[model samples]
Target: MGCASYVKRDEYDATIAELRANDARHDQRLDQIQATLEKRFADYDARFAQFEGRLHVETTAHFAYGKAEVREADKPMLADFAKTLAAHHEGVLVTVEGFTDPAGSASYNKRLGQRRADAVRDFLVSQGLDADQVRTVSYGEADNRQIRPGAWGDDGLANRRVALVIDFVEAVAAR
Candidate 1:
């Protein structure tokens, strides 16, 4: 009976040792997987940062008060901007935003802003830019930049203009 009890104790000890070894192996594998995931995430973050650095925004367009037409003097600037956009044909997005002063009625200002944005967009398209890449938005009087007391003339003119925002899409790495 004593010998039988001793044998049972030995078997129990062996079973516990095997379980401990298996647990150690599993923990090592889990640590390896965790390290791999961390490395992958760090690589992704670095690549995304590099891609974001290449993106750009430009507000180079402006307009006159109560006018939706692109001025003759500004046409050359728009043409140059279009040439720049053409050079970067890879997933470029141009947003033409029209803003107005707080002088006209809300509804009227909205329509005027829309017309101004449309005019700028049309000019860009005519200058060999992709129509699909160019989009228009009317800020009306909501985004007035000359809202100070007794502001007029040049101050108001500053608000009554179109802004061109240029953005680029993520560039995929070549194999």
Candidate 2:
């Protein structure tokens, strides 16, 4: 009976050793997978940064003082911008940011900015851009470039413009 108990103890010890070896192997494999995933994500981040660096806001659509209408002269420029966006940024989201000079009450300027953004959005949609891909936001006097003590006239006109911004989309599974 003593010999039989010794044999059973040895068998149990061997089984535990095998399980420890298997666990170690699994841990090594998980480490390798994590390293590979980390490298891939680093590469993805670098590529995204490069793409973002190349993107610039298109600010060709300038507006007159207190007006939200798209001028006849600026229509062609807007058309070109829409075509470029539609061609290059398919499936990407676009934001039309509207700005205004500090010439009126804050609320009025905000509403005017929104109207200008909407006008630009409508024109872009009319020029073959998907409406769902476009959105509008009013910065109003918040981002007014002409708010300096000595700034006036053309500065205000420059401030009253619509800028087209592109938003990058990433795959949900990656996150």
Candidate 3:
């Protein structure tokens, strides 16, 4: 009877030991799964952040609209506008794109557009903006305003203006 009792006690002890080992293995696997889930969520968050940054640039803020008809009278406003541009688009490159309405001859409009772009570039330089940071292009009437045949008027005034565009080759971290 004493030997039988000893054998029963040993069996009980071994059963408890086996249960403890199983519980430890289960806890370890649970920890590993939790760690993997955290890593995956972090990766997904990073990808969405990059995608949102590109969307912000594309959706908001038009870097266009210089001034009306590059006239001597527009000179003062040109300086003011340069400061505005510098303040708004400080680190980004600025391009002076000029366009014209469809009324003028194609060749004349082309030359006019070039002149308009040049005028804007000069104004920006005079206002302490770096000349190297600014570029100029002329589209003339190639990308003219679209309006109904007779309904077109000075409504196209906005179209006959220079535009500044900022670009990014890759997703940049915000400062």
Candidate 4:
């Protein structure tokens, strides 16, 4: 007769219980990570507004007045945004629209705005987004688009911003 080995019933139960505990720990950790990411995204003041036409998603992030460089604090949020764009959204055009706080001449502000937009677009591209899929536009102290017109310096921070628009060409319904 060949010798046979068997696991006791208690031993089997303990093994299964251990596996369940490990799985639960993993689940809880995942939940914690998710909450952290959500909070970080919100803290950066990211807003999304969907348009009825071709504009699918609009997320705006404020920038420092008269500065074209992307802030270091904004990187994590931007990376997350870029990841979402790369993972879920495809065949969509990403437009980064730059605005100014009316701190200078209209022409100068326009160029500053374009630099801001280009900086953001470059960052997005660095985060794995396609360069061709992204474009930049400068509104540059447009009165209509300003959050607080004639408000520059500390008060005009809100007006200085870059808005990213995801244009869904294929998703548009037939006219």
Considering every candidate listed, which one attains the maximal lDDT?
A: 4
Report every candidate's CA lDDT: 0.63, 0.66, 0.50, 0.74
True lDDT of residue 88, candidate 2: 48
Error of 2 at 153 (Å): 4.6
lDDT (Cα, tens digit) per residue for candidate 4, span 1-175: 9999999999999999986785565445334433544455675666544443333233456688678889887777778877766765666567899999988899999999999999999999999888988889999999998878889999998888888766543332222
Model 3 lDDT tens row, 1-175: 3554345888999989986785565445334433543343342211111122121111111112333345654555446545644554444345676666656677876777777778778877889677876677777767433222222135555446555443222212222
Q: Which 10-residue window in model 4 sums to the lowest lDDT?
A: 50-59
Per-residue CA lDDT of model 2 for 1-117, tens digit only, reads 355434588899998998678556544533443354334344221111113212335454678888999988778767766775676445545678887887788799899989999
Residue 62 miss distance in model 2 (angstroms): 1.3
What residue runs in model 2 are displaced by over 4 Å at the alpha carbon? 1-54, 143-155, 169-175
- Compute each candidate's TM-score over C-alphas: 0.58, 0.61, 0.45, 0.69
- What does candidate 3 score on TM? 0.45
Ordered by TM-score, highest first, the candidates read: 4, 2, 1, 3
Error of 4 at 141 (Å): 0.2
Off by over 4 Å in 3: 1-69, 72-77, 84-90, 144-156, 167-175
Instruction: Order the candidates by lDDT, highest first.
Output: 4, 2, 1, 3
